[model samples]
Each structure stands twice: as structure tokens, then as C-alpha cells.
Target: MDGPGHGDAALSAPTLTAREAGLVGCRQCTRVCEAADERCPRCGARLSSRDPGALQRVWAWWLAGALLFIPANTYPMLITSTVGRASEATIVGGVIELLHYGSYGVAGIVFFASVMIPVGKFVAIAYLAILVQRGHRTKPKHLLHLFEFVEWIGRWSMIDVFVVAILVALVQFDLIATINPGIAAVCFALSVVFTMLSALSFDSRAIWDRIKTLSND
Candidate 1:
């Protein structure tokens, strides 16, 4: 007649945030110390629940990454020289060529990794930055999860750069065929790096701070 855990349902475990508990966690070593403490004893890093310039740094890097991303997709990513002929391929063109060659799986992987992932990261990072900056209290937990996902996926976005690097290094044939990385490769690499820095500069604790503020109000 009773639901699962019905006997313990009335007993609630209240959640307490570090700020609510008068604690500050070191960003470097995650050492918990009293909020009154000026620095973390374990790592000696300055402790703060929220970074005042977090959004500014995040926006700066985000803008740089977004700007570089335009040229990265527009220009050729690779230049292949075969005998007397030379061909250049942009990111989309490269994927299309792979598909034309019946390498569907490889093409899909390239398209997803090179195009979709980067764009998605840009959108996700922008969304998180805006939400935190605006101090939106709606679904703070979900926003925190989104921030973590963006951070986790940041490194993987460099797959295209890695592939280009490997090809530029391994595919060398004097008179037969040779592959060289194009300008877009540099732009794309820089875009990935900037976006990664943007994600790293973001302070996820800001999301919870907004939530706590709203709760207290």
C-alpha cells in the first residue's frame, strides 16, 4: 500500500552550499576553508566563491574564438599536391570529398568533429556565459551540468587539428603526392585553443551563487 521509501520520505536531507556553510573552496586544489580565510592553506591560492572578471575573460576568449572560426571554415584546411596538379579543400569540402569516395563513416566523423562539435561548443559556452552574467536563477543545476559538459568536450574539439597535423607529417610523397596543412588549419587550431580558454575561464560557481541569492531573496 506504500510507495518505495515511504517510511523515510518525511525525513528530508537539506542541501547546503559552501557559501551557505561559510566555506570557500580553492580553485586550484579544491581545498575547503572558512570564508574568512584569505588564501587556501593547502595550495595557497586565493579563494573566492565567485570570480568578478569571469564573464569578461570568457567573453573575450569567446569572441576571439568565434572570429577565428569564421575563417577556419571559409578557407582551405588542406592542400594536396599530386604530380603536377594541386587541390585545396575546406573543412566542408573535405567532408564532401570523403563522402564522394564512399567513406561515409569517416566523412561523418570528420563533419561531426570538425563542424558540429565546434559550433555546438561555441553555442554552449556562449549560453553558459550569458546565463551566468545575467544571473539567471532558472535551472542552475542544469546550467552547471551544461558548463561541465562544455569543459569536458573542449579538448576533444581539437580532433580536426590533430588529424591535419598527422596528415601533414605522415603524407609526404616527393613527386607522387603530398599533403600540407593550410591557413585554415592554423585558424581552426587557434579557435579551438581560444574556446578552450574561454571554457576554462568561466566560473561555474557563479551559477550556484545566483541560485543562492534568489533563494535568500
Candidate 2:
């Protein structure tokens, strides 16, 4: 008799893909249609089984985000003026200042949202891009989950920028006290936006496609 794992392939049925079923998915609206479809009737979007340049676009935006992130961290995010004194704080410097003031909760929140999350996103995006590009044997479902996570967290990275904007708006006393957003705030915002675009431009479907090709080979 065969062992438990010996007949697993025979026990599991083959999964049918949309392409295999003579269907094409609209990239914009995500509506499935006949393989013969040249355009989506509902949204007038061009139909393709896969994007030829998806990875290229992903890498392009990812590079842009990474480049901007450097200046975002190096330059001061906020400039504070009080009477005759003025000071500037970068993102990490501001977090450290918060920690010094015993605002542990706020420091932790800001550090997590601004620092950890953005760095995690950078790593996650690059990992996914490399995996899909190389057609590695990793499970497609896992890659999809990572992609979804990257998408979900894209907006939250802007928390630091939002805080700076609020401070710039509310703290104004002409000379007694004033807060203004620095170059880092703009750079950080643009970095977040670019990373969000990088994640969006990636085609998650490529994960399945790469795995399928590997399986066939």
C-alpha cells in the first residue's frame, strides 16, 4: 500500500486558472471576461492576462521611494521657534526627544508608525519583487498575503507627516512659539506616496503565474 504522502497528488484535484478556463481579468475593475476580450465593457479598461511591465513599474517606484526616504530621515522634519531660540528635529530625533520627555506611549507610536513600518514596507516590497522576478518556489498565497499587508499599511506611514502638519498649523504665537514643517516633512510624505504607488503597481497575480510556471516546469 502507498504511504500517506505518496498519493497526495492523486487525492488533490488540479486547480483551474482563469486563463485555463478561457477567461481574462480586467486589471482596473477586476471583472473576469472571455479570453477573447480586448477591453472591459464595464470599465473600458484594456484586458490582459498579465502585465508585461508590472515588475518594471514596481521597481521604478520602489527606487524612487527609497531615494526620497534617505533625505527624509537625514533632514529635519520640524523647525520650532520660541522667542529668540530655534531648534530643528528629524523624525528619529523627534522620537528620541519624546522618549526623553517620558512620553513613552507617544514615542513608541511614532517610532512604530514612522520608522518601523516604513522600513518594513521597503523590505517587504523588495522581497516580493525579487521573489516574483525569480519565480522562486515560495507559496503564492503567502506572497499574496504579504502584498495585501503592504497595501493596507501604505497609508498609515504618513502619521508622522500628519503630526508635523498639525503642529505647524496649531502652534503659532508670532514670536513666543511657532512650529513649521521642514524639508523632511515634504520628503517623507513624497516617500510614503511613492512607496504606496510601488505597492499598487505590483501585480499580485504574477505570484500565481510564477508558481504555476514553476510547477509546469
Regions more than 4 Å wrong, model 2: 1-14, 27-30
| Every model: Cα RMSD to truth | 4.0, 5.2
**lDDT of candidate 2 vs native?**
0.91
lDDT of 1: 0.87
lDDT of 1 at 204: 80
Q: Which candidate number would show the highest lDDT if scored against the true structure?
A: 2
Residue-wise lDDT of candidate 2 within 1-217, one digit each (tens)? Answer: 4655577655553477677778997878878788888999889998888889999999999999999999999999999999979999999999999999999999999999999988999999999999999888997778898899989988998999999989999999997999988999989999999999999999888888888889899
In terms of lDDT, the poorest run of 10 residues in model 2 is: 5-14
- List clash counts for every candidate, in order: 0, 0
